[model samples]
Target: MKKIPVLFILVLLLAFWGCSQKEKKVSVKKVGPIDPQMVQDQDDMTWEDYKPIPEISWADPSIKPKRGFKMALVAVDFPDQPFVITQPKGSDLFGNPQIDPIKREDVAQFYRDFFIKPSDVNHGQTINGYWMEQSRGEFGITEVDAYGPYQLPKNLWEYGLNEWGQNDFTPDGSKPKGRMERDVDSLWRAEYGDLRKNYDAILRIYASYDETGVWQEFGEMKFNSKEDIPPEWGNPNPDKPRWVATRYVPWTSWKAGAMQWGISSIRQGENSGTITHELGHYAFRIGDNNNNPYVEPYRRAGSGPWDMMDRGCFNGPGGPHKRWVVPAIAGASMPAGLMVRNRMKNDFLTEDDILRLSRDSLAVTGLAVANITARAVEPFEGEYAGVIVELDGEEPHDRTPVDDPAENPLSPGIPNYDYYSLEVVQRIGYDSYCPDNGVLLAKNRDKESRNGGVNQFNCFNWVIDAHPEDINMVDYDKPNGEKVMRTIADYRQLNDALFHAGLNSGSEFEYDDPYNRLHFYIIDLHRNQEGILSYTIGVKSLDGSGAAKRDFQLTAPKTTKESVALFTLKNKDKKAGLDASCFDNDIYRLAVSTEGEGLKAEILNELAVVSSGEEISIPVYFSEEDGEKSDVRITLTAVSESDPSKKMEASYVIP
Candidate 1:
């Protein structure tokens, strides 16, 4: 090669060095902390500063359909296939089991009777009740033209359908295709030729075999090969150890291309809840809300048993598994309905039905109250107008008071980053079986975050449990010993979760969001005779100051009898709190008192400042040191600022 110029030679040498330096720098770069500007200043914030913002956002579907939604029902069967038809067996506490068989005509008629009429076949009702109610009567399967029990040329497996325990058989690869796809195509070709145009959706159901159903095998069939069959199966006409009926569909999917909603197969006694769940996916395009417990590591419950989108729809005394019994004995075990967020997204809730509170609106002093309606039902004209309260701080709710990176193996990208959300969870219709009714307080990060390179809080919604882990609440543990961490699983926790306040108003639910930036205090909760839940939520700056300050007057003891010191605590704070708005309640603690070690104080009437004029009696028990009738002066105080000393006080004489 020709001799290189001196400058070129030097440049080549420098380039080699630079590559080495770049490799060294790679190990040092780390993601920067959350922007300071994004954090809200907690120093002077108060409830008065909070102005609610709209929480619900209706979905803007690009493909909006006409006013009403209609669907076509296609019942399919295979050629000469030995389809097992089941009838109710001996009646017992658990009801009946599938033991008898019917003809193809009977299977087709069974589906027809299920959709066209309301009968005991489906828990003494039809799917019309659930679909109509869930869609708020806006959607129904008005016209169901049943086709099929129509025979297909392929065997059950070739058609991409198989009975439970029969899935191990493989195809010849003569026609390589996805089993489910093949099944859908075959059904569509046979029954959906001219009728696809008349409906907004399509439901394809098959008779007999349950692919995912939980059933008991009565030893009618042999586990070995044909040649290895047992002597009990001497007459293999019907094949001994006949398969017990169970769910046939392994998974539910939307065939957008064919505009078809197909089921692998419908068992004899399925309910409307299951159908509605599939409809939720097909009609609304909403994803399942239930957590994947089978996953590794943090197998946390997805949305848990609260939302219809989650396992809560399977809510009943016996839980999800009990739902399999045909002619459902558990009544309607499906979830009450969708959560507040889903309702808003689906347009089931109008703007007027919600109350929106945002961080910007919280700068001034004011009290906001909302009588929220149950999200499951169609919200009345204005129910959605006032239920939202957002306290967005400069810092995310989860990121403050930073968690050490080393400790959080699943470090959610930003620490303590969250926004607070408060809503009322009421028991009505499907929600009737919910463990308890209360105002649900939750924190959410609408977006995803990664810590240590793994997704944490993937759903981004965390319903703050008033009691995170109390045996009396949710005691059941998974096989791996992981507890079912959800509010619905526990009895007492769900009950205590309600903001039902009184003097002994249970425990205070405290959430420290934005690290040292903001605090959410669920001061009190109340429910009306109409079953509307209202919560008094307080937002304060980390500095312990807010527009709504605690103000109360402590009157002298009614009588210093029985070594008990009594004083009346009243809500005299002119600022007022959330409870003051509508369904208001007050909570007070003995901030400071001279009664010291010499006495014990007990709040006799559950701690609640029900009305502004109402007084809460606080009784202080005298210790042996003070004696029963000692002339002493005690000053009772209430919270005002960071230090309870900033609050108001009163002197009482125990005579």
Candidate 2:
């Protein structure tokens, strides 16, 4: 072999060493715990701040609907119970008057405007407006014909006292009178023979409150114990206890337990009802996404307060307890907008509205990044309303372990999820009543079904809670002053489930699922001039380094404030390497450590994203507990989410 120069051999060795170092992977360092105090709450939001949707009325001559539904609104009252509208009673049942009583014709017009016309009573919100907004003006109730403040043959208690062990407590000590549906439909049919065939659906506005709205407010929530329930609120038979067995909880006041729950069947509702939720079922066939909240062996909520099909139906001015208010101005009034999954199920979203990918394809595609607009508004052109990653490939594509919810209620149930979904929620439109606004991440199934086993509840959409630990919120105080904590399964437990970006934002910026071989990152948040929210998000497979060559450079720390150090991280790749077509942006997870006595350090922004040749600045705040001067050494590390091997670290020393 020809002799090679030693200098040339040295150059080859140096190049090989540099290349090896570039491909070397670095283990991720543990970051400090997120500050619980940093989490944001929706308490500041009020009805005044709500972003209004353009009002659409059924009576408008210029308005027309494409997939319009013509609904018939029939009001019926029992012989024993008169319409609350005509009576205008107090806060308590049949007590002193609160608002002035209206005539029967006025009641009919009230509902007419409530359902289809934008009016002051409905907060400029109507069923037609809700549907039109949700469907992007594609579907709505274009016409609603009002009929009948008619009277039914049976007594109010007869039809109302039919559920939750209330039949035995009837005033006559006889079986409950009859079905509200049969009696109400019979009355409507008697007047206009089989007239229901003319409309898409009939909305039966009955005489009292929706049982769901009053059950807790009047039951255990009202009285400390069953014995404390007043006789007036009890069943007619004095021998029977004032409380009766009810759904979820063990007992409730007889009156509340007896009242019928609002149902999709002929869409029967009451003065304080979740009519929109019923309309969801009546029109779209969307099943309830709720679980038994007050029961034992608690299970986590499915979609929680983020979806209309869930407890989000009870969203309005005040929290759930205020649902008993008449004319439905409080809870169960303006329900949350439909989530991406339900919207797709209802065909409300077009193909362009969702960016779809396959879990198997992600391995080849590297990391996928997109900006997702809030579900309540239209996405900007070329952006998506949501992202869906289909769990495709192996027989059991979802590798999540099935743990016992009885042991850990926070456990992800069943491990049979079909896909993952990501979308943003903003306090705009109907979502104005939602608890907070942030990126919503969840595991979902193609079809709605129960998880079976101990957590035998609906398992269609399982939201990944950012804070899985108990929120430790008190649901209510007993009459005796004992506090009743909200259960782990309570839908409100997910009130803080959203994932937010940036440091001190009162939410997590990223989630890692080693079992599912996926990592999700909420890189940043954006709000348009119109007050619509969107998030720049990234999803990468753990099994592969992304298709693009990932590299970044961190600048030396600069002191901006007395105890704050700022650093700029720039994506060093001048060009999209290897796969330019697939390259989006580089996301980095940052951590900081301090070496000093009584000193603590926190990264204001723990996660960052930079497009090719772009940069972002991160700030680290340091504090001393003892108020004593000491030399401090701060080490900041950045790890590329696309390729963990590309890691960089910088240190700043303060004397």
Candidate that scores best on TM-score = 2
lDDT per residue as tens, model 1, 287-348: 55443332234333434556655555555435544444443334223444565555556665
| lDDT (CA) per prediction | 0.42, 0.74
TM-scores for every candidate against the unseen true structure: 0.62, 0.86
The alpha-carbon lDDT assigned to residue 164 of candidate 1 equals 30
Location of the lowest summed lDDT over 10 successive residues in candidate 2: 1-10
Give model 1's TM-score versus the native structure: 0.62
